[model samples]
Target: MKVHVHVSLKPGVLDPQGRAIHHALEGLGFIGVNDVRAGRLIELDVADDTSDAALDDMCRKLLANMVIENYRIEKVAA
Candidate 1:
């Protein structure tokens, strides 16, 4: 089985990295760019029997910071 995790900063959180990237893009002559937010994607290969609850636990414990970041999970066929 394959699992995907997306971790992103919640609204109103400071994102210095994203701001830097946005600035860089503007410098490159890109127009109409309002804001930029960055996130991470994690792909995992686990046993077919892995439960959804366990995957959620993984995100809560280590993959995402609940205070400032949110996570979404997707299961895929391998």
Candidate 2:
């Protein structure tokens, strides 16, 4: 089994890295881009019997910072 986790800042939080990337895009001549927010993706390969609850716990405990970020999990069959 495989899992993917996306971690991102909560709404209303400022993302300086995202802002810098947006500026770089503009300098490269891309137009009409309104905004940009940066985030992280974590991938895991686990046993077939791994549970969603366990995965969620992993996210809360170590994979994400609850004070500022939220996480989403996706499971895939490998």
The lDDT for every candidate, in the order shown, is 0.95, 0.95
> What is the C-alpha lDDT profile of model 1 across 1-78, one tens digit per residue?
989999999999999999999999999999999999999999999999999999999999999999999999988767
What C-alpha lDDT, on a 0 to 100 scale, does residue 34 get in candidate 1?
A: 98
Off by over 4 Å in 2: none
Give a tens-digit lDDT track for model 2, residues 1-78. Answer: 899999999998999999999999999999999999999999999888888999999999999999999999998667
lDDT of 2: 0.95
| Residue 9 local lDDT, model 2 | 93
What TM-score does each of the candidates earn?
Answer: 0.94, 0.96
Model 1 misses residue 62 by how many Å?
Answer: 0.4
**In model 1, which runs have C-alpha deviations exceeding 4 angstroms?**
none
